[model samples]
Target: MEKKKLITDDGIRYDGRKLDELRPIKFQIGTLKNADGSAYVEWGRTKILVGVFGPRESHPKHLALADRCYIRARYHMAPFSVEERKSPAPSRREIELSKVMREALEPAIFAEFFPRTTIDIFAEVLQADGSTRCAAISAASLALTDAGVPMRDLVSSMAVAKVEGKLVLDVIDQEDKQGDSDMPMAIMPSKNVITLIQMDGLLTHEEFIQSVELAKKGCMEVYAKQKEALEEHFKKTMDREEV
Candidate 1:
């Protein structure tokens, strides 16, 4: 197969992006009122919403330490998110993805500050074309910030994939299905520290390097959006106070 061939021989990929381009993103913080913090983000066709609850009171059977807050995350897809309706039950895939997302977010958050409490991150996928896991992580990060949770740095995530023997940034749904491999990564941009990384399929060392580079480029874009959203949130709050 020609690998779905969204791009043509003239050097254009599907959606008219260059090999290393990512989708445009729109993000905002404080979308929810009751939650401590919340954010919403949309990357191309992928839409995700995240809500944060507490740094307060760990539930029964605190298997983790009480000296620091526990980080819990849930990843869910709505029935109408995809072309086909999804099952309501929480499947293994969602559980695993949730775990990775939690890890990616924990380091950036000052979880120890809330000792004996729990921080719950809930992510809902309203529409998913590709890179939903990355979207979830990004959204959760923003929601934490919106919730006024202290953190060392902002975390952003992106995905890179191999298509037709070439590396591409921010794979779309169709590309994901047809691509040879996919790698999703979360990073703390200022520190250049990688928080979470996952990959599927195979790649040579050279390909891996190219994919990581492309993913970093995409992540930088995501970070920019994250900052913009936070600034907007604060600006609105300041405006409200003034009024």
Candidate 2:
């Protein structure tokens, strides 16, 4: 099948965004009451909810670490999240994504503070357009903060892609499906340290470097929004207390 042109000659994407432009993004903290901490994120058309629990005893005995807390992340997509109905069973992709998500956020967490315990993070894709994994990690970081987990810094993430021979930031579903390459990265924005980087497709050495730089810029933008959401949540709580 022939792929549709993802980038126009004038440097416009199918959605009319510039090569470096990102779609609209919004975030909400403390969206779930039952979980210790929770957050909701909407990035472009992708929607995700993350719930953080534990820092309690690790179950099954063997999973507990003697020196530091363990972080477990579960990534799931709702049956209705995509255009086609997805099966309820967990797919291999979800399993791998869960592992990477845990690893991405583990570095920023002060797990030694709660040794021999576990911190469980649950990420559900309420909607999927593209970059769901990146959105999940971003939301999960905030949820951990909402749960009052100690951390060195917040983790921010974004995806950059090559479409029609041009590198772009934050590709949507169509771009991901038809683009030449996709690279997602997670970093500690305050510390300027990368925790996770994954890529699919191909790129030259220079293009790889450029893509990482672009991804960093996109993640910084997301970090700002995350800070804003947390601040808004706290402000509302303080107002309620005063009342």
- What overall lDDT goes with each candidate model? 0.88, 0.94
Question: How do the predictions measure up, each by TM-score?
Answer: 0.94, 0.96
Model 1 C-alpha RMSD to native: 2.6
User: Looking at model 1, which ten-residue stretch has the lowest summed lDDT?
Assistant: 234-243
Across residues 1-243, which tens digit of lDDT does each residue of candidate 1 receive?
555677778657888988887788899788888999998888999999899998767786554566788888999998889898988688898999989999999899988888878889999999999999999999898888878899999899999988878788888988788888999999999999999988898999988988788888889999998888878778854655553
Error of 2 at 206 (Å): 0.7
Clashes of each: 1, 0
Q: State the displacement of the C-alpha of residue 91, model 1, in Å, after optimal TM-score superposition.
A: 1.2
Q: Residues 49-70, candidate 2, lDDT per residue (tens digit)? A: 9999989889977999999998
The RMSD of every model to the true structure, in order and in angstroms, is 2.6, 2.3
